[model samples]
Target: MSDNTTHPERCRCCGTMAVHRRLLDQDPGYARRRSRIEEHAFRAMRGTIVQRPGCTRIPVVVHVVYNTDEQNISREQIDSQIEILNEDFRKANADISTVPAPFAPVAADARLLFALAASDPDGNPTDGITRTRTDVSGFVDDDKVKADASGGKDAWPADEYLNIWVCPLSGGLLGYAQFPGGPAATDGVVVTYTGFGNMGTARAPFDLGRTTTHEIGHWLNLFHIWGDDGTGCSGSDFVDDTPNQGGANLGKPTFPKVSCDNGPDGDMFMNYMDYVDDDTMVMFTEGQVARMQACLDGPRSAIGEMVSCTPLHPKALPKDTPKEFTKEPIKDPPKERPKDNPKEFVKEPVKESVKEGPKDLIKDGIKDGGKELPKDNPKDFGKDPGLEPGKWKPLDPPPKQIFEVPTKQLVEGPVGGKQAFENPLPGGWGNQPVQPMQPMQPAQPLQPFVLATGQAPSGASLKPPVADGGGEQDQSQALLGEYAQLLAQYAQLYQQGMLDQQGMLAWQQAWAAYVQLGGR
Candidate 1:
């Protein structure tokens, strides 16, 4: 029987139903509160991304993780995505076929560019993109499949590389994206194979190849043009310059749309993050460029830490030929062979070539498919930190097996989010008012629970298990997660048992404090 009480709350990194349910159960108002926090966060971050003519160029490492050879999309496809970013940010989209002749002149060109790296995050040499091959395919929206290293997803140094996971999007959606600064914010891109590029599996017009450009915009902190209201026009996207939009547009919109009486530019339908076919969506407003810049300059400034701060690369290496052969000892040297001529001595072949050179095969990033992916739905998680009685389980001793995590790709075709999830306008996440004063109490120094990296034991889900043979495994690492889960379950049971209101508040407070302390 399906466990309705525990709805697949596992971390995408590790398939354990061990994730904290607090985030899922969070009141929708939390989004509004989070947006409020984002406002101040963006205002504070804008200062960092502004690059004047001679400003430092941010160096970035791109890790291209593929499930297999066919899913191994090429280097050029990666390059194309970068090219689109440079163009979109600089407001130099190749063409505005949708723009009426009247407004083509004011198109803005925000300045940005992405390149194959000339240096590694550590001031070493590199070619910007690294490729990994994983046996896993059929990417799902679920994060568990993609996180390979940690019992959860192991990330490339989040502060340094721009990790892009390339795999077949199992679901038809162009992959989903995470905004900066959330717990999972450190995660990388998951572009769908066919949904990714304009030239390859990517289709045309809609495939003008802007899906990634749009998602990355989300990565860098830009919102859907209509402010992602998900519905309703009363909400405002918060940007002063953008005209109020009634909701999200799905199929190609004819010009002069009269919703919310927006007009002239109509719906700003050409904006990135809209549902129009790729080619139809064209520009990002100066405000959007500013917002994105603010993001790069702000909360995500770590992305710049490894960028072109240095200027050198080891482009070549020495050959392995030995320079000078060591001479034989006196006794061995006495029998010199006759040469064609003393002056024209013949050379002897040496059995060993002692040469020093840079290792060429050292990959710039983790190789995918090097490990088997934990099965899609790990059947049983042995000792779930959370979940209910007899539902989840945990891995007693963690296995050190390397894994294949889910990589994301673009959501191709006209976006049908309208059907699956409504994005009606003006009042979504973007429009939510900024309540900047939400108090962030100073972090209380509390004892931290030990976290062991483990996977789901088989039963219902497919989490990987660490093997310690038969001896009793040390489980101190289960830490805050199990406790947090237990606490939640206890509260649920207490609520159902007619616990007094004060008792419930105490339970809720204790739970809130645990999460506040980053429990699990």
Candidate 2:
């Protein structure tokens, strides 16, 4: 029999709690570690323990285990997911505005940033993505996906890297995560390929990169908002701010959804821990943030203490090179050769030859053989045939301007000859005297400009005068208004998850038309 739980079609199901239970039964040390971790979290939840100030940057390594080409996702998809994580964790997501007003004040910025590791655990440069070809068709929550022996990629060191496995998942499971205090080898989160990111094979209702966000929340020690109680009102997620709820809120539940006598402001279905659709869930509560910080400060403290997202400089040395070479400085070669060496040079003859010089040797050769030597310059070398002695000629100068205005004419006005007035005005004002005209008295201050209630004022029309090309200008303005309206509608539909593929294509076509019509 399969260990996976069968869920209703289209329901959001996670295997984390079940896996946690199984681990508790299988490993006693894990239970002890869990107890310690929960104690730290409790202290953090109260005012006893304090979290480190400022943001914590964690390095991530994505292992892409694929049985087929589609299962092997692209680096772009991986990067998109990372970007989403950064935005969501920092409360920088654009859809945070969708969080209801009642819960908005408690929506916390986790102040955590996740980036793909730029260097592997071995200190080699990496893009932080690993691709493994596996014989297994699909993976489940059995931890087989965390080991190479079982046809999956083994993880990097858990203390230095957050290992995330993306592969084909069976049993309709979207994803699962190993919470803090888990065994090191099987640490980190596993997300199904289709539900991992917003692009590539990611499907709707689960797309928008929320599955990884939800799984990472679990990895950071957050519980499901519904407390994993399966409709029991008594269970708690251990966060005081979050309301006590019966079970996971599937699909998209409207605001003020009453459950477990939690009314007025009911279940915060929009929290990241809830099992809502990607578009529906948009926030993390302050209590959840505190719990995650506690995990970072306790069981996962080592990973957060240092950042390994930057590439290591001067990557690992070649395997064949001696390890001592890196530690010791190389000595200079010997200054002098041994006298008795077989390959010793005949330096005396070389010194004599250098003193004799090439000019002396050339002269002696010419005198002895009486052979005529070639002239220094080769005949006709670089000499243009047309430029020889009497054949030399110069080309005529370029033609002068067709007509030149006289200097006096240029200095004078356009009419030529002389200025209209000999005494031109000062400051280059042509011919008119510099007159100091009297300033007119300010127009009688219009009677306070106040009107009685509902009284009309007597005045000239305030409408602006139409200039030349006003009709075309008006038409263009109207088109601009229409373009703006279309853009606004496009953005609204996109944010609200109402636009389909065809609708997007139509919007693109309309945008192209607007650009062609000279709309900005």
Candidate 3:
């Protein structure tokens, strides 16, 4: 305090002045915060992917809680933000007047869209907008907004709606978002108004308005365009076709400019997620969209659920107005899409019918022993029903969408690939090859059922059924005999008082008849 400016630095702990020691002795607040952030990241991976299909659209409520004057943004700007999201997620962000021809052809149209939610988490219709004034204003490290967990955003039925908080923070970091595991897992994305869009909250020129587009990209599980790898392209964001590049690009790159050893493609400097200055950014690739979708389907489905309301759509629903009436926008350089005549909000009601689903094997032919063996022929035991023995083994169905995402219903709601779960079987779901009953020889000679490595009593080799004899009745008789032994045991146990009493007498009579015909 003697002289603030020229005073030599000193360790607060011991007053030993040394430039290095003073710098090191500062509060250490930032480093501690970083450790906490990392620790929370570790907690996120223990999560689950969304597994159902055709879940309904999820609704979202944007609460713009502002304090400072700059944070004061208009609804139009917010609407533009939602529009950019729809185009980016849907992979339909076409309309290339903004991008150079060379890059236009390669632009990926993400398969997702956004809308002002039509209802609240309680299923009541809403304008999907809310405003609050908070002393909390300024830039933040994560997203520009969040559904506060404790009183801040209030505990939302997170699996049903996204709570976007537009507030200020003290960090210079761009924007940040949570990675799956869910709303409780991490705070929602946070962005600075100046960086939100070219339209709202931002100044012009710098506002070619893709900030929200970029931040929302992260919200959908996309990483930075440069892959955030210190090694760049070699580290990849795990996408299949995106060329790798070292670091992010700031102000736009002149055509044919090259950097990051990502030759040929040079740098994906134009990708929206890159750190490039506003006007320079142009597109998000299909590969990037897919990667994001994988996240949506896998660990982040809960967030995706915020898009749906019930067993149906989780969040962003489609326009009720016919496709022809809606405005088709993309993440084009700002002002490309007409923000003037915004489409009227359409609250499309979702319809679901639990039509008769296929009956499961367990519900049908299965018996006390799982399922009646096709006719105890020696050859039937453990053999694929005519399936090429080598070609078919147990396999999962191909992955499918957790939500019944109708590709054709692209007009209905947000079509995030993240919301899609791959059907886990080959040839997709319903095409599951029927698993024919295994061929186990007649009872007493075989083990009940077998595991992948389980063996049966020797002579596991089947004695094929005689072409003319040992009729179906004989086979049924043999199986019935086995059932009789089980029934007798049940009765004997009851007689010895080991079984529950009320039904004991009926069980005994059933056992007597069951054993009459060649009971084991």
Candidate 2 structure quality by residue, lDDT tens digits, 461-498: 11112345576557555654555455445444443455
In the predicted model 2, the residue pairs found to clash are: none
Please report the candidate that would top lDDT against the real structure.
2
lDDT at 208 for candidate 3? 50
**Alpha carbon lDDT of each predicted model:** 0.46, 0.71, 0.45
What lDDT tens digits, residue by residue, belong to model 1 across residues 1-520?
0111132211011111112123223334333333333543333322212333322244445555566666566777767777776666555565544565544554445455555567664777877766666665565555543466522234456566655655665534455555554454335556666656666656544455576777666666555555443344644443445566776665567876657777666667666756566767777665565565566655666565323322221112223323333344544555664434453433332212222222322332224333333543244454453466433222221222111111110111013422100121123422233222222222421101100111111111111122356321222223234334434343333423534654444344334333333442
- What is the number of backbone collisions in each predicted candidate, taken in the order shown? 71, 0, 80
Q: Order of all candidates by lDDT, from best down to worst? A: 2, 1, 3
Q: How many Å off is the CA of 381 in candidate 2?
A: 92
TM-score of each: 0.49, 0.58, 0.46
**What tens digits encode model 3's per-residue C-alpha lDDT throughout 1-520?**
0111231121001011111123224424322332222222211221111224433233566666677656767878887777656654444343334665566666765555456778777778788776656655453433224434332345355555565555554433334444333335333445545555447566543465566666666555555655554334434443434566765555557765566665664766778776666666667775575555555554445654433322212134455645645455433435743454333222222112122233444456465344445556555755645767433322321223223234433222122322111111124322223223234345423222211112221211211122255574665455454444444344333323444532443343333333333332
**Where is the poorest 10-residue window by lDDT in model 2?**
447-456
| Residue runs of model 2 more than 4 Å from their true location after superposition | 1-9, 305-520
Window of ten residues with lowest summed lDDT in model 1: 447-456
Tell me each candidate's RMSD, in Å, in order: 27.0, 28.0, 25.3
